[model samples]
Target: MIRAKTILALLSLAAPAVAGDIPLAPPIDCTLGETCFIQNYVDRDPGPGAADFACGGLTYDGHKGTDFALPTEADMARGVSVLSVAPGTVKATRDGMPDIAMDRPGAPALDGRDCGNGVVVSHGEGWETQYCHLREGSVAVRKGMRVAKGTVLGQVGLSGRTEFPHVHLSVRRDGRVVDPFDPASGPATCGRAAAAPLWQNPLPYAPGGLVGAGFSTTVPGFDAVKAGLASPATLPAGAPALVLWAHAFGGRAGDAVAFEIDGPGGARIFEHRATLDRAQVRFFRAAGRRPPAGGWPDGAYRGTAQLMRGDEVLGQRTVTLRIGG
Candidate 1:
């Protein structure tokens, strides 16, 4: 297998360097501890097989960009900036694309011309980057405008052919698609990829793991949560139902999963524990409970989930919701 260092050496010997090491910065300003994550990366394989930045199946066929996905549209509604990764001039942009989540009924159908509100910037030396799925009306720069690295271009959104809230950043060299994580910008074999990564700092890549955890006023299906549907910001005190849900990808048959909801008063309102009997590309689990007859005490409700394999915790997430009114 060709290692990263080997790829870097080969690249230096084969051609002139492009100014210096990859001068790109992350396109988003979000923390990546447990909530926000890179859900997918540019697929390297030219065929139907999948591959991610770390040489995994976290990507799908024909996917040509890195998807920095957020937990929910509620988070997108709160505003998450998509930043410019390198100093460049805006070459093109499209805006006014409705920032409607895919699961919302009657969401407008998109065409090839609709990348759903995006910006394309051209850095020197034939390097161009495209940021896709920006929030409606959030394009901050116009064509021909100059921008510095880390400049705020817009907010991430669920637009175009997307099912989740994320900014799909596509990098290109001389109009050819490139994978920033791969030195040759080509397919990765095994877990080895070629030379210097594009990010100024190391960007963490998540395998098929926990995508998000959240509390909803109504029970949510797996697709609903992924498409950011019915995400309530605040739960009414007397609401009939409150559900805690989690979404995960690349689940194996023997994985152990747990979900729980805790009331404001620290009472465990709902809990579920199970072991998957079949492998799944994506899986979801939820547990819900209604408030007592007297009504829920207004404060905080916590939802938590954990995916386990034997004694090892593969992934875990926690979400808190406020109960008012």
Candidate 2:
């Protein structure tokens, strides 16, 4: 069963991607030690005001930004360092924000400081690496102070918007963030930018679950094994409704990832096929399929996900569903 194989492949990566085995480099080198908990990063791109996004396995809306732990290395708390990814001047800094405490290992530390006390460095011409949730009052470089790449700008702290401690860092080029894991150098900038969306992915650091796998989002709280549907799951009337989020990863580009969402009556309410990105995507809304009347009647729905590697169903996931109003 090509489809069954594809489903299996996708499931294989799911646990590790969510739990971890995230890389540090081979990759790129950050000012901090080798990267760990690759699975737990949050998408805090282009610095402050940039749309925050989820980089973690789970989506914690607006809680975007990688929450690297303090040096698990000797002589340090779990997360306690903040450094520069590149050379620049302090463009902005903020401190004294409330901090949230975390008990989960590899989970973000501190509060308000998801990336720990935010710091934005101008690279001239609008290029920047927005670092955040830094140790309060520990900013070494103020606005206009020159810095070098990998410089220890400040200590990672569990301040504003954070639950654990670690450097919450990201790189921005021309007002948009580049995948820090695979950064390309160019002239920098310091332009006022629009509020960025909380990015669902930084893309540089992908969740393990995405690779060679079929994935989907349940209604806020879905039990993978249950054949349950969304409760009062509402979509804008006539608004193209696609699964909350469906992506395929590790499948090569040009390869297709297919999805079929069944409505009542065994009808294929949603079906889509698209080339997979390093991550896969099967957004059916673009296909003009809106949710059925009564917002998908209380019933059973099933989803079949297929991953094709050059016409091969390398993996797949068939999920059971139950919908109710």
Candidate 3:
């Protein structure tokens, strides 16, 4: 494991000859204690991060807080139990208050429903953490309350500005929401429990690896399929038969995966396709696991899935199967 002091020492050295260990970036004051993540892979911004979320197909003021997820599903639902990112005071809380809702399915707009049934914990030095999208009528604390880390803020849900159920975790400073994506672009507000630092690429750490960033689905080194069937136990006519399922391990809230499904005949069924999110988990089950909703007839089929970067393919794998009655 790489130590923080070594990283700092490298930063202090004149100029190292190592490839990835050079000193060019600025020094960031990373918190060595508490850490924070998006809960899902694509918890910040858009692109590969938002691939695994069913809500990714939608938009919100060109700014998406947590990744697209549906945390209230039966499979991979249930978002992370809201907690205090750091020691702070509850600045506000709302219960039974009507929140802003999305008008359409693809675009984002403004709604007064800020932090749906949520809380704002204020930290020292003008720092703060936000626990939004809480379960309706489940709030415990009131405004002006104090809380510590690991404190149960509320239950996760798909509240305001969301299409599916998920948590909307964010950090703020002096009333301004801070970016949790690029750690180098800002200061360290909390320590990370997943990765060593909070700024590491959130995709690779996603429940599954970054879609379009690495191999879409890993090929289990040898040969075998886990989780959902690649060809599925069955499929409907005209519907894409070749499908693959992936789940992120330790994935952040905003990470995404990009891949495509292909038929055994080499026909592309799902090009640049991606799974959906339901908050912290990266499993495709969050988006309704119905490869062929009505169930497909018996048949022989095969398919492949891969991650990509625009036109560049990263990781990939093949899935084969035979549908029987």
How many Å off is the CA of 8 in candidate 3?
22
How well does model 3 score by local distance difference test?
Answer: 0.40
How does model 2 score by TM-score?
Answer: 0.38
Q: Which candidate is the best by lDDT?
A: 1
Error of 1 at 320 (Å): 7.1
TM-score of each: 0.75, 0.38, 0.46
What lDDT tens digits, residue by residue, belong to model 2 across residues 1-325?
6443323222112111222122221112233222332323333343333222222222233333345543222212333446675567888877665444443245443444344467787766566777765666666667777877666677665565543344565656576545433232221112322222222222233232222112234322222211122222433333334453332323345566667878667877778776645532212111224565655565666667665667666545565555653
- Model 3, position 141: C-alpha lDDT score: 76
Q: Candidate 1: misplaced stretches above 4 Å? A: 1-21, 102-104, 211-244, 249-254, 260-271, 275-283, 288-303, 309-311, 319-325
**Which candidate ranks first by TM-score, i.e. highest?**
1
Evaluate model 3: give its TM-score.
0.46
Clashes in predicted model 1: 0
Please list the C-alpha lDDT of all candidates, in the order they appear. Answer: 0.75, 0.44, 0.40
Quote the positional error of residue 85 for candidate 1 in Å: 0.3
lDDT of 1 at 220: 75
- What are the per-model numbers of colliding residue pairs? 0, 68, 38
